[model samples]
Target: MSVTIETPNAPLADAQAMNEVASSIGLDWVGMEGIALPIEIAGRPVSATVNAGIDLLAIENGQKGIHMSRLYQALDELTQSELTPALIKSTLTQFIISHQGQASCAHLHFSGDILLSRPSLLSEMRGWKAYPFEIDARLDHQWMLTLKIGVPYSSTCPSSAALSVQVAQQQFSLDFDHQPDAISVQQVSDWFDKRGLPATPHSQRSWAWVTVTLGQDAAQFPVTELINRIETALSTPVQTAVKRSDEQAFAIANGQNLMFCEDAARRLYRALNNQCHFDQVAIRVEHQESLHAHNAVALAVWKRGSHAA
Candidate 1:
């Protein structure tokens, strides 16, 4: 009681291949963004968001669109190995090869948070800290790689500390004015215990954004090394596992290493400039002030041959 008609065998339609373009204008970049992927960083696997693209130069020849699926497939296949300069170069090469004559340049960007076990300042305890980092790669005339990282630290305002000290001195003078002859080390200690300081300097959590242009000879991303170097130079890296002793040590470190945003920028500039791996470096430091509505910031840049080592 039922009859069915057979369908004809025909090639599927491809609009990207068959459609005519409205204009022959070329695009600087064309591809995918916010692709979820797993990438190895610092000898561990972490989830990353990636963006892949290539220049659509063949549009001048009336090419309507690029094969975006090819870019996705290439990223899915090539990112299995540990991320390194060699791997990035290979990925970019695959992008160009997949598009053949349609693309001459390729770009890749990926970002992830890396977890590192950090020891307590003055204790045997340790805890984890996550560092957010980004890697950008491009291949045109030659390969170029850039590494960027955000580092959190404590910034104590030098001016505020000085003012705090002056207020403390004035308070001490007023308290011991009537008993000048009775002033002794023990009496002074007792007075400090009873009255404490009238004022305390303000400190706030701060950040340093470090960007570096890696030389072609760079084998791997130096994320941990760069973080350590910056933390050491600034000397007030935010703590993770903190005992009372560790907290006191951190407070002492902040007191001894008071700096403004400009000082932090200069310290990072000098620290990174001494390294031979980077051809250029840029630094931006931000102090999230507790006293003001606006944040304090400083910027600095260094080139390879422009400065003497």
Candidate 2:
């Protein structure tokens, strides 16, 4: 087979040629783009399906481009092997050393949708869906190695629930008090009287991003474990399946344990703080309101195994 390729930059192998240009000029990060390759994520695995976004930056100044071909080859190697935080740390180390560590840090962001299989309630049907996820790996002399993972979830506000209940009751009482038609209103009033104006706490689409400092020679994290913690803390996990029973069950669950975005963020922050492996972590939640036009948000951070002060 033969090939003809044209481009604005030269091949990556000519490191010597690129270095001569870069050494003289002060530059930060440099590398390739859209270099597709399969990656074995921690929670999900698919062959030739994982695409990793690859880049390599030179620590030196005036560097035009790192060897794009070498970066592509590195990605190829990453696919055949395991794609873990530890592997990513090692990958960044290679990137730094390749360019003589001229810049102090190197990073790679790998993003892909992970397919999840969920069992339906009552129906026993198996439903599958994809969630957006990403792994951020970076290497620095001071920071050593840091890996961050992001997962999307949902949050509900407890205050909203109390308000809804109040509104439902007051309106019911005013419209139907002491009248023949008042019976239906009475029932509504009773329900609202028990519940408030915002009878249900607002639930919002949210995400949790966790950062970890890798131990010696470690590449990947316990992604499965991290995911478990997220689901557990949120309690009222949103679903991709919406059968009649599922909807009812979800409503019941949310109504029972109504939470605010702040609550959700605190829950996750505390959960990660208790974990021993992570040296630091950050949790954030965003609540999209059905009752209002603006979204509510909450955030928490943990450092050195303690909640950030």
Candidate 3:
């Protein structure tokens, strides 16, 4: 019988060797990033493909770059079953411990689309849609876990309604001015005022970026709930499938609650402040206008007990 031998490449072992070399030289922020991996979202088990950016930062000034190989080796330990919070916590804990607590900080960036089934209003047809979402998680010596999320939504301009009404009324008045049987401009204006006519709301696609951090021994926070709050605060969420009824309802909802970019930002801030999950908060919202060539943006941050006005 003939015998054959094979050699296996060990990335983790290589990483450890690299870590030792970097440590001997004194380095900072040694880690591997932009790694692609599949994950589960909304229980559909879709690929959580993310460009995982990992950084291990040191507080002291004497260190050079960190042991990049060791960091990569540690990340390779992650498997499908080891992606949960407990697993992540343990991973981070080991990272700090393995580095002799020299690297006091770690950050992770993960993103994926949430594929969902939305029912059509008339035909009851199931439509599949993907909503893009991201998670920015970080750990520090303070035992803090910060998570950031970006949510896409839509906003309607209530201020535009008043202007639309004025323009439409002026046009009506000009056309009927010479007619004897035509109602006067005052009458027309009054009619529009009473019926809220001639008022058209302007709309734009909007997005909100929310960040939250927990204190040591902090209560459990459901990231999904925070996302839901942000969507609700924006007043209008992106629809997967639209039917006649859905379109009509959307219009009605927007008409009742028109907002500007500034309004959207404040609304989100208020919603988060009221929820009071973290001691500090930051919010940013942008409106990609449909009528203009440029986009409008608003931002707000608060660290005090109350949100900024």
Scored by CA lDDT, what does every candidate get? 0.89, 0.62, 0.63
Badly placed stretches (over 4 Å) of model 2 are 1-22, 46-65, 96-105, 121-123, 140-150, 171-202, 217-219
For model 2, how does the per-residue alpha-carbon lDDT over 1-309 read when each residue is reduced to its tens digit? 987667648755644344454455544456554545666766467433322222334345445555545555666557666676556666766766665644556667666666778665456666775655555565676435455555666555667667776776676666567667436656775755764454345666666666655555554656666666787777666677678988777777677666777777777777777766676676666677776888777777777845563
lDDT tens digits by residue: candidate 1, 1-309: 898646657676666665446526667999989999998988878899999999987454455778899888888764577888988898899999988877899999999898899998999989998888999999999989999999999999999999999999999988888884867899989988998878999999999999999999999999999999999999999999899999999999999999999999999988998789998898999999999999999999888887732
Tell me how far the alpha carbon of residue 37 in candidate 2 is from the true structure, in angstroms, after superposition: 2.1
Candidate whose TM-score is highest: 1
TM-score of each: 0.94, 0.74, 0.73
Candidate 1 TM-score, C-alpha based: 0.94
* Model 1, global lDDT: 0.89
* Better lDDT candidate (1, 2): 1
The reply for model 1, stretches above 4 Å from the true place, is 1-9, 58-61
> How many clashes show up in model 3?
9
Report how far residue 166 has shifted in candidate 2, in Å: 1.3
Better of 1 and 3 by lDDT: 1
